[model samples]
Target chain A: MFLTVLSILGACLLIAQTTVLARMPPWLGNPDLLFLLVLFVAVKVDTFRGIILVMIYGLMMDIFSGFVPGLYPAVYLGLFLTIRYASRHVIVDEPVHLPPLAAASYLFCSGAIFLYMTIFNPGTDILWSWRDLLLQMFILAILALPSFHVLGRIAARIASNRRRIFSTAKGGNRFIS
Target chain B: MRKRSKRTRPIRQFLVISTCIVLFGVLALSFMGRKELTLPHRLIFDILGTAQSGVTGIINYVLDIRNDYIDLIGVKKENARLREEIKRHQALTVDYREALATNVRLRKLLDFKEQIPQPTITARIIGRDPSEWFKTFSIDRSSSDGVGKGMPVVTVEGVVGQILDGGNHRAKVLQAIDPNSAIEVLIQDTRTQGIIKGTGDSYRLHYVLRNNEINPGDLLITSGLGGVFPKGLPVGRVSSVVSKRRGMFLDIEVEPMVDFSKLENVIVIMKSNQLTE
Candidate 1:
């Protein structure tokens, strides 16, 4: 059930990213809503399910984006696993951690993309602009707290519903085993 | 407990090994270009493209209505301005009549029409590239509309880009201002040759010798050397030229004639036998 909701959210964000956000003014920058969602899942959801959904998000990114078919999935899975592991030990779940985490993830993802293209598709003259990357990071940082807040609410609701179902099945009011 | 740990160890090892193998396989497959889309990808593209078209159409309609309202606010002033402009153009039409006659005679003498009646299909832009690195966009026309990859796209102002790929109902265009794009061009006044390459928002002309005299306002038109575009199509004007003391070539910048930021419509050349190599 949680996977279904995340999948639907991913699909909606993909559609809007391709259709609406793509049309926004070039200078304002396009925030990676899908990337934020993946981070949200990694921090709030179980690792196994979060990784699976992040992989799906990557596949959708590959489709909507003009990149190679499997490019995004590989990059996204790596990022997802990294974030999943880091959140276990670090205090990365709070809203205040959103800016730095978002910036780091954005740089990692963008750098990985450039590296992959450079290694695989040699002689492809890619214009690497740090200005554009910085602009995107700034926008993502601004959006991170609000975006995570909404995703956290959804994750909490899903978790509570699962707890309720489990308790009802065991014929007990308290969920503690 | 020791015996159970022993049993789970092999399963864990197998899962780890299998996961690594799968990821490497996916990466390898992606590393090699997959030109053909899987059936599922095609189906998804079809559905999403249709939805995008519908949503874009409605959005454009609302925007047009709002623009109309804005235009109404200045309609009277614009009407007066246009009336004066028409009078000025009417006076200029007499000179234009003579020039048109001269142009017809010159064209006939040069057999211009014999090799230049190219057919073009108009297309509307539906979406733009989601990423900033690759300057590309999707247009409403596709293979079903007689559009195909490698077709040159242009607008009334000048060259736009080339068709990169096509689904049944839509096609993706790689814009002229992308890093991957390159076009052979000639300076209109001096006939100097150089390659115009995309540098994100603008174009940069390359390969001209450092000693070459190129003014900032000189026009750059397609040389048609590679047969992708026809001869004499406007590409851009040289916006700036810098002669570096260390390099053998000049660092020249071109301001594209067509404003990509404002592009909403384009024309795709269907066929021109004279231009096709």
Candidate 2:
């Protein structure tokens, strides 16, 4: 389990490096590996580890990015907690429509970004246009989906195989012991 | 215990979705009107910011070369064309000299207030911040050039933003187009007094009296009310006027004279003879 989480963190660091270095050469769009990790934990991980990972991820982000000290970590971790709590009690249908889920995720991300900026910059006069944010969110999600699909498949394979390994252990208790 | 079947999950699903949606909205709203972004948040923003500036530099470089740079075969032709244009402009300057001299003398006779004497340094705007929300920028000049905080910066066109911070050889300017920037302005014709501000898109004339005799197309100039700015510098032109009988204050929109976003080169005005401390 520790190795798995470490691997995920390693991948995220790689993504962050790419974001800073090769990133959309002249394009301002930097991919959010943080968001990807949050979504992965919220959906794939269960139990206390999921919640712990949220805080861990948020802290890592705070340490790495130049956002306000506590804002993003608190907000993102809060999002993770909300997602985790919901997943505990609710059943997400498999073969679910990806768009709605993507939209929901996009909304969550926007809210987090907005909250962080608004809270930290009180006196700064900024026109918070919901229309602009919504438009940008949808567009970003659409772009993210192509990449998300490939990652999602890899993720699902890993998760399913992990489940298989655990269940086999359950059936062969005497032999294993 | 056997796990609960999926059949009973949707009711629970509705409740969860509704709760999550509500929680997100509330969290988002909680962030509104926050006073200061914590240091960590600012750091993340800066990293992203640096990356953004890097991108802007690349884009501007490419755009500049595309617009002006040409293949070897075409370079000479372009250069010659620019030289001829410059020569024509020089000839026109000679023709305008007499009238220009007259305008200057008349302005002196009218007793245009003397520009306060202070030491000054000039710099060029090198990079603009990625997020318009911050309304900040990085310039090429810095401490090595004697730039420092609280120094009022201006362009050949008009007052830009002040120097907020600086590095060894580079400085950051808070552009006048930034929503956070506020300047005192006077209308050219009416001499109407009001504060000029930016709304991230354009400059606005705010705090005008409801009954002020203002109209569209009025030229707004710096009143020098703030000790930071020199008098009579062009600020912007009044773009719109809002009048409602019961309205507590007049809503006036002014378009800034300078295109802050497209700012490439700028002049730094120093109070005459003042040196960087």
Strongest candidate by TM-score: 1
DockQ of 1: 0.30
Which 10-residue span in candidate 2 chain A carries the lowest summed lDDT?
Answer: A18-27
lDDT (Cα, tens digit) per residue for candidate 2, span B1-277: 2356566688899989999999999877976888888676899999999999999999999988877655766878889999999999999998799679756644542342234355556566654443213466667787667777656777655677887766787777777877678999899999889998877667878888987899899998889888777788888888999887786678898887876644555656554333543
* The 10-residue segment with the lowest total lDDT in model 1 chain A: A62-71
Q: Candidate 1, A173: how far from true, in Å? A: 10
lDDT of 2 at A1: 57
Q: Please state the CAPRI-style docking class of candidate 1.
A: acceptable
Highest DockQ scorer: 1
Model 2, runs deviating above 4 Å: A1-106, A109-122, A147-177, B1-127, B167-170, B268-277
List the candidate 1 regions with Cα displacement exceeding 4 Å.
A157-177, B1-116, B271-277
TM-score, one value per model = 0.68, 0.51
lDDT, candidate 2, A1-177, per-residue tens: 543654576446534433343224323443454565566666666647766776776665543333245655677667777766776676532335344555577577566666666777665555455655565456445645554565567667777877888788556457676
